[model samples]
Target: MAVRVSTDTFEAEVKNGGKAVIADFYSDSCVPCKRLSPVLAEIEEEQGDRVKLVKININFDGALAEKYGVMSVPTLIFFKDGEEISRLNGAVKKSEIVSEIDKI
Candidate 1:
């Protein structure tokens, strides 16, 4: 399951977790974000305890979006050891996401 994130707790929850974090920076009004939600869920399900997903709504957490330089919705950023290692934008296929995860 993806953890809903806010600017206030984004760091504590993602950066310091000591695990790889897949942060999905999205907005409710974005069609592509909606399309990618289930795909992310499937990744989480298949990955099991190997990774963590953090869902951040840019509408409510604008600061986080700016900090991460997310100019668009559905920006998937992968963090390991509290640092960003990879990213993907827009609605992407499940295989692409899995491939990115595998790299990390």
Candidate 2:
């Protein structure tokens, strides 16, 4: 399962985490964002104990969205410590997301 993030927990949850964090920056109103949720869940399940999945509501805190340059929904940002390492915009296949995660 992924943790729902907001401006409140954004720093501690993603930036300070010891493990690599994959944050799915999205909004509820976006169709593609909704579509990618389940695939992310599958990634979470399949990679249990290996990585952490976090979902950020771009609508809740636009700063994070802007900071990451998330121009679209379903943007996936892979972070190592506090720095962003990789990013995928729009809804992507689960396999591709996993492959990106594997590279980290």
Candidate 3:
């Protein structure tokens, strides 16, 4: 399962973690966010050892969203070695996400 991150935990869980991180910025009422959840879960299940998945709820973590410059729901920010490497906005396919992960 993806870890739910808040501003308090974001740095430790994402930036300092010893794996590639996928920070999923989403809103509770977003339809596309709902659709993207399972796809992310599958990727997490398959790549648990290689990558780390974390979720930030835009409604609750608005500051964190703004800090990351997330302007939309379902924005996936890929991080490696404490820096963002790539981002995908919207409901992306599992294959597409995997391809991005592969780059890190």
Candidate 4:
């Protein structure tokens, strides 16, 4: 399973990790978020050592959503060295997300 984070763990896992990070900013009510959940889980299981999957519930942790300008559900943000590199603004395929991260 992906490492699910809340407002409390955001900074430690993302800002201080000093590695590439992929965060899924979503809400419980968003269907697309649910749809993307399994895909992310699979990716975590398959490539856990290479990339860290961080799942954040927007409703509970609005700080990151607002900070990242997440206006929609199933937003995927990729960051390296605590800085954002790219953002996918909707439910996306696993291959697509992986391809984007590979470039980073």
Best-performing candidate as measured by lDDT? 3
Root-mean-square deviation (CA) per prediction: 1.0, 1.2, 0.7, 1.3
User: By TM-score, who's the top model here?
Assistant: 3
Give the true-structure RMSD of model 4: 1.3
Candidate 2, superposed: residue stretches over 4 Å from native = none
- The regions of model 4 sitting more than 4 angstroms off are none
How many pairs collide in each candidate, listed in order?
0, 0, 0, 0
TM-score of each: 0.95, 0.92, 0.97, 0.91
The whole-model C-alpha lDDT of candidate 1 against the native structure comes to: 0.90
Prediction 2 global C-alpha lDDT: 0.87
Whole-model Cα lDDT of every candidate shown, in order: 0.90, 0.87, 0.94, 0.85
Tens digits of per-residue lDDT for model 2, 10-48? 889887647788999988899999999999899889885
Q: What is candidate 1's TM-score against the reference? A: 0.95
